[model samples]
Target: MFARVVVTNMGNEMFNDGLFYTEQAELHKDQQFNKWRYCRSAIICFCVAAEAELAKLIAHSLRKQPHLSPEYTEILLFLTDPNSDKPIPKKLKNIRKKYNLLRRLNGLRPQKPDQRYMELTELRNKIIHYTFSSHEDVYAGTILDSTKIARDAVRDFIADLYSIVRETPPEWVNNNSSIDIQ
Candidate 1:
């Protein structure tokens, strides 16, 4: 029997929402209106969703290992804050650190977040903390580029995990295509 892992759908939903916002922004731009506001928010939403999806994948994969199950449970508890007292942000940071450590122990190279992933994260932070005068100032093109990078990173990470779960390289790995959730 094949082991089944339930993947979260939130990432796909958020990505779709981001696309909708991008389309709206484009429409506004064509109509000679400011598009940056929506575009910036869209990118941030997409990044957040993608990160959630990636974290889910990592946690799911790690939990499958009998030896790591205990650690996985702790991480989940930290993330959920069942105690209702732990700072969620700090717990989230610790979870990311632990995830990286597990990735390294699993023999995956580039255990840390990918360069593009890190860049998108930083961009998301800047957008959230600072203000831009115009959509042009934020460089809509750059946001679009970061979106592609973020998507590719998620795809690659999923592909790698799928390969491990199947004990072989899945067809998507060779084809450079998205994994079919079925």
Candidate 2:
């Protein structure tokens, strides 16, 4: 089991719906083109939820696959600007990736689902930099639903990856808590 933690940063770019972010009221606002900062953190209650639900997934994997000596954690941090290099720490150099800059501005993901995870993971290179934008959503539309499509892709990928583990043996002290109804 390979465990990883990911943080989603919300950029502060005003949309037609309202400012980049305003409180929970804006998110639930009923409008024709309702908009909210489509980042990864949704703060609610005394608890919080990933605006993207991607964190829950990483935790779920840790619980289900203890055999791989799994110990992983993640933080879904929100950002005010895509190019806000100020908040980024020196130690967390891995945060810079080409694909991430794109995801922040437009919802366009990597060309292939397999490269999605690391597509935005390589932009920190001093010699080669990833591009960021402060424009309207170029990849908007039904395809902003790219995340949903990616979810389906992940489900299918995991199904195949874990098939052998499930078949390793039924009596090997099974633990099914690691998986959720994807």
Candidate 3:
């Protein structure tokens, strides 16, 4: 028998964080430095939240198969290990691979993230690594557009996951709940 993993309110938490950062960005729009920083932060936060939601869905699917419990545990451990030196991109790729495999097994078509999502990820990396020009060069409109892209990406991802989960039998879902994996 598989151990029941209770998914928590991580999805809600992620959404809330995204909302908070977006609001912060709006509040700081008058200041170039603050506006760019906050807007970039908001986009990155949304991406992070979207990735978390993906992980949750993958974990939930894995937990449905008793034989895959050990692998599922390993995935959880790897993801939560703050000391691990693996890059975020590599980790995300691994998770995506697993998610794709599970989707294939369930006869679901594979869905690649949109180009805007990739662009947002690249932008987030550039900002985090200080690869961009001075803050004064960062236009408010660009920041706003990036924020919208991130928000839309997260919304689409969540909708896809919900559709997949809905197709699964209730008993296969632990507690008939969404996985938190936070």
Best by TM-score: 3
Q: Write down the RMSD of candidate 1 (Cα, Å).
A: 7.1
Tens digit per residue, CA lDDT, model 3, 113-149: 5556666766666666663473432444677667755
lDDT of 2 at 125: 22
Candidate 2 clashes between residue pairs 3 or more apart in a chain or in different chains: 10-79, 12-80, 40-51, 64-178, 96-123, 97-120, 97-122, 97-123
**lDDT tens digits, residue span 1-182, model 2:** 99988653211111111112223224444432332223111111101111112222332343454342311211112122334445443222232232232232232343432343222112112112323441222223432233223233333333322332332211211221122211
Candidate ranking under lDDT, highest first, comes to 3, 1, 2
Superior candidate under lDDT, 2 versus 3: 3
> Per-residue CA lDDT of candidate 1, range 64-163, in tens?
6667555456665554454756444333473346446446546665356556656666677777766665434356555555644554554565454444
The candidate that achieves the highest lDDT relative to the unseen native structure: 3
TM, every model: 0.61, 0.25, 0.66
- Greater-TM-score candidate between 1 and 2: 1
Q: Which ten residues in a row have the lowest lDDT in candidate 2?
A: 40-49
Clashing pairs in 1: none
TM-score of 1: 0.61
Candidate 1 or 3, higher TM-score? Answer: 3
lDDT of 3 at 89: 35
RMSD of 2: 15.1
Stretches > 4 Å off in candidate 3:
1-8, 69-73, 76-99, 132-141, 167-182
